[model samples]
Structures are given as C-alpha cells and as structure tokens.
Target: MTRHQTSNNRAVLRTAAVPARKTLGGGGAAFLAALLLLSCSNPSGPKRNEAKIQGVVYRNDTRTPVPGATIVLERPVSVATAGEGGSYSMAFTADTTYITNVIATMPGFRSDTEQVVVVPQKTSTVDLYLRADTSSPVTPSQSGDAANIYLVDFTPEFISVSGTGANDVAKLTFQVRDAHGTPVDSAHGVTVAFSITNGPSRGEYIFPSSAPTDPRTGKVTVSLNAGTKSGVVQILATAQVGTKMIGSEPVRMTIFGGLPDQAHFSIAPQMYNFPGLDWLNRTDQIMVLVGDKYSNPVQPRTAVYFETAGGVVDASGYTDAAGLAGVTLRSGNPIGNDPVYGPGFAYLKARTVGENGATVKDSILILFSGFPTEMTLSPSSFNLPVGDQAGEVFTYRIADRFGHPMAEGAAVNVTSDGAPVVLSGDVNLEFPDTQSSSWTTFHFKVNRKESDPGAKSGNVAINIKVTGQNGNRSISLTGYVAY
Candidate 1:
C-alpha cells in the first residue's frame, strides 16, 4: 500500500506493497491482485488533518485594509501574502493543538504580531493592525524632533475666571503623527509634554504635564483649571522622539467675567449743578464706574440702572471696556429740593448686580437750577455828570425762587437807549459757593463821554436784560446826564 501526506504545503510519500505469497493458491493470488487494483482505482482517499489561520490586515489609524501585506507564521516558519482586500489564509497539517505567532507587515508600516492557536482539523481566525512609521532614525548627537506633533482639539475655549460648573475647566487633546499624517503612538517611541507658554500669573494650571502617547489612537488628553485672575491663556504641546523634540503651534483660551465690588463702585456727574429746572433742552451727563474685587475692570456689557428723585434719567445703560456707563438727565418739572443744599438739588442713584447676586448701589447729589425769580439793582438809576470820563460803578444781584443763585452761565447785557455808554463788567454769572450768599452779583462801570449823544440829550435810559435757563428778564432805568 502506498500512502501520501501533505503538511505546510510540502508532500511526503510512504509505500507499503506486499509481495504475492507462493504458498497461496492461484485464486488467492488473483483475489489479492484484484484487491490491489481496486485499492489503486478507488477515487476515495484517507482524510487529511489540517488547520488554517485567516483574517484581514488593517491600518491602525484609519482601520482601512492594507493590501499586499506579508503574513508570517513563526512556529513552522510558513509565509503567506495578503490579497487585494488585505485578506490572507494559511493552512497546515497538524497532529495536535499548538500555539504560534502571526506577524503582518507592509512597506512604510510598522509590523504587527498576534499570538494564535491552531487545533487539528480546526480553523482559527486572527486579525492584525499596523501603524505607519512617521519618524526617521536619529543620531545621539541630534536634537529631538517635534515636527509630527499637533494640538488637535480643545474644549471650552472661553471660560469664566474661577467660575463654577462648565466654565471652570478646559480639555485639550494632542496627537503625534508621521510625515504622511498617520497617527503614531507610544509603540513608536513617541511621548508628549504640555506647558503654559503665555497666561496670567498663577491664573491657570494643567494636569499630567507629561505623558506617553496612546498606543491605539496616538493621542493624549489633559485638563486645564482656571484661577482667580482673568486673561488670555496659551498652551503648547511638544513631542519627544528619541533625541529630537518637535513642538506644535500654541493654543489660546480666554478667561473672562469679573463681578463688580462695592469698594470700586462709584457715581459721578459731569457737573454738580446744571440748568435743568424748567428748560426741557438742558441736559446733564451722569456716569458710573465699576471694578472687580481684584481691582480689574468688570466685563464689558455689564448692566447699570439709573434713578433720580427729580427730572428724567435714562433707565438703563451698559458698561464699556473701561467699566464705565453713562446716562443723560434731562431737565423736567417736579424739581427736587434739599433742605441743606436748597432748591435744584436731587438724589441720583446707580445700581448693579454684584458677584454674590446682591445689588450694589452708589448715590450722588445733582443740583438743577432754573431762571432767577428775583433781581435787585442798586439805586435803580445811574446819575453821571457831563464829561465824566471816570466811570461810576453800579451793582446788580439775582437769585432763584429758593434764594439760591441761578445756574452758572447766565448772561447779562446792559445798554443805553439815547447813546452807547461804555460799560465794563462780566457778562456771565458763576454759581455761588456755600460760604457765599445765595445771591449772584454783577458789577458794571458806566462812563459819560464829552462826545456822547446821551450827554447832549440830558436824559438817558439805561436798559438791562438777563437771560436764564427757562426765562428772560428786562429792566429799564432813567438816567440824567447833567450839562
């Protein structure tokens, strides 16, 4: 009898043919010959014991098939080539179950190895994933290369300074890649380090400053915590490969929103006193300035509310970058009066929400004065001798209804009907101080010239007019110029 066997694609033959026995009868010999012929002619043969290993080869980064990859079996030293679809199959005759390593490799990719077990007459499946070799061999004298390192993604790019919940922390992810943009992991001897390049002093911190790249994804993630200060933060990631260092572009994050504090909150008026009595066109500017507990300006667009005891004020305004907000107070009816400051005085208040969710307020005194209700002229008439070049002085006083001086910038004009007399004095009035009387006074010098026509008429009328915020007053006095 002749037997044939195959293992690992190699053939082996064994022959077991018996010589015809002389002692046997001719019939027996014929029967034996028939049996031999029958055995040789039979189509059915002994079943061969075989085991197979088959699977697909894929790229680690993209999970895509890697065609033309070479597959090798270590124990029996058998080799197979992957087909167009990255599929490979290896079959071998096995008498017993055994363990072996299967390695997959391709050009420009790192080899992958997986341990597999083969059972007699049983098929085992094993898949392999390969990574791209993005780095070149480096010498000990060379510096580290970080060209393949990248800061891929970051979360919460804008956060509040030391805020709670989602606004308190940020997440950053970095990847190491090869020249072909394939992800390379720690298996390729790549590591990453993180740092804060530009940020507020002691205002931010990161966790796991240094770490090895992930073997599967070639990525590393870290957390950044915001501090008490508000400003911009910049982070950098560096890849360390052998002796070379590769750095990625820096990433920027912002920390904003500082709440207002009472110590730094204030209200100011452009002027303490304005002509806001009954003059609807008159207006005053009121401003509010706010700052955080750290003495930094509050965030822009913060809301501020305004209220006044008298007149009309803008209801609301928003702060600017400088933490300043302004509103206009227009003159109207219902003038406010203060017992101490007298008439035209009102309380103006500004308020905002603080960090603690409480209302922060500031108040200031604003005085709105109207036209003067009383006016007095000393002597009521001017007496000048003819050819008197040395001018005679006269005084006039004006006051509001509450015995307070009219608002500043009141105008006074004096003229003579018969002749133009030379007059010298201030044409505008200034607000009176607390130490001074409530009346605002003006003085003028009246001169009679020898060539004056008023001296020839012997009787001249002195005309005086005063203009106030909401009204005007006129006075006429008869003056005699003796000849």
Candidate 2:
C-alpha cells in the first residue's frame, strides 16, 4: 500500500510492503507471495534563501521608543510598522549580500534613514532616531517646556556713546528652543525677555525688552541704545515656559569713544627736533591724543585742527579709533632765528571741540637745527715748551650762522701736521637744554714728544674740520713746538 500526505505547505511520501494471497495462482492453496509498493508525491521545489532587517525607532533627544512608526525599505520596496515595543522587521529574498536604505517616519516627527547590509540567511539590526519637526508646532516635553534661550545674532557689538553717530544703536536677536533643540514659537506659549545683567550704571537701554517668539522662527529681536557713559554691557535673554525660566549665556557689548575733555587733550611729536632748517623736504610726525573726562579714548573721526608758528604743518586731521590724530610737519619757510643754535623753532598747536563745546587746545615746540657756519680757535698761535711732556691747551668755538651753537651731535675732528698732539674732551656737541650756550667748544692739548726727533722743535700746523647736515667746514692754525 502507498500513501501521500500534504501539511503545512509541505508534501510527504509514504511506501508500504505487504504479503499477497494470490501471487502464484496455480499454487492457490499452498503458497503466500510478497509485494512491494512505491509512492511518489508531486515536487514542492527548494526552500527560498532570505535576509531580514530589524530595529527599534526612538526619539532623537530622549531616546524613548516611538510606536506606530512606519519603517520603509528601498530597492524592492517593502514596508513595516513598528510594534508596541517600537520594533520593526522586514524580510527580503537574497542570494548574496546587498545594501538597502531603511527609513523610519512618524507624524509630528522628522524622518530618519539608515543604510543596512542584508546577508543571505542572516538578520541585520539597525536603529533609527527621529527628531521633532520644528516646521509645525509640537507639544512641549514633560521634563521642561523650554530647554534653552540662545542669542542668535547681536550686531554692532561695539557702539559709541550717546549722540555719537549711526553706530550708537545695536541690534540683538534671540531664539527659544526645546530639549530636542527645536525652536519653540508662540504656539508653545514661549516668550523672551531681555535685561542688562552687568554694565555701567544706566549705561545702556533696550527697546521692546520683552516680546513673544515668532511663530515661524521662534526669534525675538530688540534694539540697544547706548548712554553717555562708556563701559562693557552684558545683556541676558530669558524665556518663560510655564513656571520655568530659561536663560541664555551672557552677551557682551562695548560702549566706547566718548566726547573729548580739556584735561585729557594733549599733543606730542615723534621727535622733539629734526633737521627742519637748512635741510629742505624734512618732515616729522605730530600726534595728538584726546580722551574723555573718564579717561576713555574720544570718539573716532573727531576733527582736529593744526597750526604752526614756523615751518609748514598739515591743515587738519581726523582722530582714529584710539582717539589719536597725526599730522605731518614739514620743514619750509618762516624759519625761527633764535640765538642759541639758530636752529629754527616750529610752535605747533592742535585744537578740537571739547565736551562742553569749548575749544580744547595743546601746543608743542620742535626745533629745526641749522648748519654750522662759523669756527674760531682761541689764541690763533701757541707754543709747546721744551720738555719730554710739554703740552699746550687750545680752545675751538663753533657756531651756526646766527651765532647759535651747532646742533647737538655735530662731529669735529682735529689733526696736527708738524706736532704730536693728544686731544681729549667731548668731540661731539652736547645736547642743548633750558640753559644752553651760543657756541659749542672743544679743547686739545699740544705736546712736544721726546720719542720723535721731528716733534722736538719745529713749526706745527693744526687742522680742524666740522661736519653737519647743512655743510662741512675745515680750518688750519699755525703753532710751534720749542725745545
């Protein structure tokens, strides 16, 4: 006997062996025969190879399971819904390894996609995290309605004091965000308030200090106007969500460049004196630094007028951000002929409008040195007495064209033609001070040397040379060395 059975989409074949009574008909009465039976069932084909992908969907920020989420697979196109536990699984008939994108999406949440590799006969686990969509309003989390208040943009962080210019006002913008970093707008009942936490007393004021966040951007903007005082101002933005208050990091701004004051207005030059006389096309820098009554630098671009009694000076200049203005003082006509060094003096004055609308002025003196024009040797002739150490002192006076002493650091070199002279004392002119002389002097000692036969007794000639920026002069005087 043979039997065939089918169950659970599978087929089974059965075979049976039995003894038969009529196998040999002629020996009916005596013999028993054996029979064999074979049964064949219809082919059911080979089992299919498959790969699976499974994972759980979660909230991006909270990492909590999100049920009722749809998981979609590309490249064959299959979809599955997350179960109560936020778990989803999809199967694919695959012969080898392959890659596919799995996307998890839910209402009121942003969609997230992850690429997964599916190996034949194996399952791949992929986790997807989704964030709350900010395009549309979302319910606030139970933990805290507002996560943080952010300072989005603060323009013109530096502003001048009141009535300075167009830059005296600053704009500040803020945004309120939830725990998921999604901007929360008025729909969530979020409002932002601003205050000056730390700064100079009443140094700044804000307009529209409190406002509700915009529905689209969740942002609030305000304007800050500077006061008369100057200092650092820190503004804080706070958001009110339910009974909780969220504050952002402090935003810092600067109020600088106040009005100038008389006490703090002054002028200085890069060099007190330059070769302004006798040397054409010479220039020096004249700088003026102005400050407010509080010792802060005055407002930038403040005009300062310059005037000079002698020589040429820049007509005017504008102060820089540091309240410093500079002008060029050039050597030109109208030279001062003071007695001392005939070096001309250029009296420079810088004036500007002060805080009280009065003229604040400061002055400085700069000297333009003249060229050496005169030279004299006292006792035109001298004699060194006969001795191994015999010496004579000679004095030389040098002066400028106007009888004033030569400029400081003027070089004077002396040499002897017929006598051995050991020269000492200042070879360079001394810098002039309040009490200066009309002429600069140099001294030299003429000695009769025993070492040299020619130095014993003979007519000696002295040579002098004076070098200056304007010109050079050389003079010779005759003397005698006697034995």
Candidate 3:
C-alpha cells in the first residue's frame, strides 16, 4: 500500500512497511538491476528530498505546555495547531535549507516568534514561549521580583495657561508591584524621585519633590506646576529600594504660553435672508480669543486684526483683559463683488501675536442663512426595468451656503426634462421637511414613460428649483433605466 502527500508543491509517496527478501541467485540479481533502471529512467518518480518541523509551545511563567496554541510558518505560509501535549509538526520540501519564520499565538498571551532552519530528510525542533499580557487584571504574588510599575493619574494632560503663578497644576500617582502583580510594601520607606525628562522648560514638582512610598501601601502622590515657557512637559519617576532602582512609567503634559498659538471665535444670529433684494442688511457680534500653547489666555491689550472673505467687519481691535477681542461683522449689499449674502458663507478671521512673538490666528464660518446653494442626488445613476410601475428611488440632499443642511420646511420645486422621465406627481420637488442636523433627504422616483415607443436603455434628467426666504437656486441631475 502507498499513501500520497503533497508538500511545497511536490508529491511524496509514503510506502507501507514491507518484508525483506533473502539473498538471491543470478536470476534474482538480474531482476533487481532491471527494477533499478526502470526507477532511474522514470522522470515522474517520487523524490525523498523533504524535511519536517516540530515544535512545542509553553507558558513563560509556568514551564507547562500551552495546548491549542496556533503556530504559523512564514515561508509558504502554513499553520498547525498544538495538540494535547503542546506539540506541533509541519512537513515541507527541503530542496534547499528552509530558513523560515515561525510564530506561536494563544489567547490572553503575547505571541512568540522564532526563526528556524530545516535540512533535507531531517526534522528540526523549534520551541516558543508565550508570556501573559500584563495589561489584564491578574493577581500578583505576595513576594516576588518587581514585575511592573505604572502611573495612576497624569491629569490636565494639557495646560493652555502659561506661568507657574497661574496655578496650572496636574496630579501624579505612582504604584509599585511585584512579579505576581501584588503591591510591594517596604518596611523602610522607598525613596521615589521625580524629574522632567523633556520640555520647553523643566517644570517644578509642587512639594515633596522626593517622597517615600507609604509603608503600608505601595503608592505615592504628587503635584506638578507648569514652567515659564510654552512647550511639552514630560516627567519621570524612579524608586530607590535598597541597592536596586525601579523606574516608574513616564507621563507627558502640554503647556500653552500667553502668546497665542491658536484662537477661537463665535458669532451671534448666524442666519439671515434677503427679502426682495440681492443684499441682506444685518449685523452680528463676533468675539475672538487668543490662547497660548498651553491654552492659557494671552496677556491683556494684545492687538488683533479682523479680516473678511465674503463680508466686512471692524478691521482692528485689542484683546480685553480676558484675552478676548470683540468686533461687529456686517453684511453690506448682495452685489456681485459683495462679501456676504443669504446663500453663501461669510468668513471672519482674527489674527494676533503671542507673548513669545509667535503669530496666532483663528477664524469662524457663518452661513448666510437662506436657500441652499447646492443639491446632491445620491446614486446619481440608477437602474430601472422598462415598463415597471415601481421606479427607482434616489435621495436628494440639500445644503446651505456653508454646506450645512437647510432648516426644516425649506421650500423647493422639482421638474423634469425629456419624455422618458417625469416627476411622479407633476411636481416631485419639495422641502425634505426633515429636522436633520447635517443635511435633509427627500426620496424621488423616476419611471419610464409608457407612451414612449423607443423604450430601450436611456437616461432621464431632473431639474430642481429651490426658493428660500432670501432667493432662488437651481440644480439638475440624471437617472438611467433599461428596457
């Protein structure tokens, strides 16, 4: 009996055990020679140049087998599952030394990877050890080597306030533990020292710069205050226990200077309509604030310049004591060259300088409230069967000048072009009547006309005319159908 197996794209024959024959005479010798020649001449004969890989998966903590672990071979991409004893094996062609990547993975444990080499006709043994992920909640040994140390609270991750006098503070907590994850208690105090690893300027620890861990508990708490300049603030802690030094995890904090790296703006009464006229006459109170890298308000009396894109505003102003600047934005006439309108956006920007001489700027967008400037047809193209009463449905999304969804109950009129397609009820266009925050959606269906004789595959166009309290706008799109 013969069994066939494939490895590395090559067919291999595994033959059953056979009995050996005793020494033969001249006839038997001649027969044996003929058989050897036949095998040698057969180009399709099975070759014996193959190798195997065997491995065991074990847990790093407990020198025990890790059954059900998955092991993968990189070259040729083969995988094997470990059996009861955590043993796995794979066979591959070894025409050349097989240098391959081997990886082992198990749930709740970190995967292990190794490089292996297999030679022809040989079984190479490779082993892997997977470690338990520390992030999971596992009990720590009562008494063992230190396993982990981490920070508890590094709050106020960022501070926009500059200067230590401003009380821009953050809290820091540290915990020490052993290999089994059990907190380590020190009979004598464990001296933990803190330092700033990186930042624009080294920040100061509020008090007790170097403190001893609680004897009963293995924890410590401290506070940090911002530095004079603007930049990232990083802190590191280390515990000195006897002759050994244990390091706590690092933490980062950001501080903003009085000089503005960024600014914020707000506008009141954002929407207005043009009634029987091209221009809308309105005024909006705009406020701007300058903040430093740490988010701290800039110094008082900073000058901010106001600019406009589609509107006009007070050109220049000074930031108040609160780092806020106020300006009156007005929309003049709705002229071709005017900067503001009902169906468009009016942009206002406030520019200032930081205490560090850095340029700071912020801008706000106001949508001239009125009719939508643009309309979109979802699935602009769709398929419909000719003569089918049920037509394809498309979603029409309406947006205002600032790309925001039109207010509820906005008015729109729909009409069609060409004979193949028409509005379902003479006028299919209308306001979505939706209260959606982003955009409104209305369903419209297009059907093939029954009276048209040349009903094959063709396209139909739909035109939309929207009338807002301010003005009117138009848009068009097409749909498709097959007979």
- Those runs of model 2 whose alpha carbons end farther than 4 Å from true positions after fitting are 1-171, 175-184, 188-252, 336-343, 387-391, 404-418, 429-478
lDDT of 1 by residue, 190-289 (tens): 6678899998875679888988876656678988887777777888888766677887888888765477788889999876666667577578899999
For model 1 the TM-score comes to: 0.53
Q: What TM-score, over all chains together, does every model reach?
A: 0.53, 0.55, 0.31
Q: Count the clashes in each prediction.
A: 11, 1, 19
What does the lDDT come to for candidate 3?
0.59
lDDT by candidate, in order shown: 0.68, 0.68, 0.59
Model 1 weakest lDDT span, ten residues long: 136-145
Positional deviation of residue 75's Cα in model 2 after best superposition, in angstroms: 27
The TM-score, computed over Cα atoms with residue i paired to residue i, of candidate 2 is 0.55
**Candidate 3 Cα errors over 4 Å, as ranges:** 1-147, 160-167, 202-206, 258-289, 292-483
C-alpha RMSD of each candidate structure in angstroms? 22.6, 21.4, 24.5
Clashing pairs in 2: 340-404
lDDT of 2 by residue, 1-483 (tens): 222221221222222211221112344213211111110122322655776777777766545467777776664456678886677888867665666566676666766766666666876677766665444233333222567878878787467777643367889888777785656644564767889888777557988889887765567898888887777888888876677788989989887767778899989887564555777667888999988776777877889999987688899999887889999998878786545334466578999887558889999877676666668887788876766474667788776655455554556787778656555554434344211454466677766666666555678888888875545788888987776
User: Global CA lDDT of candidate 2, please?
Assistant: 0.68
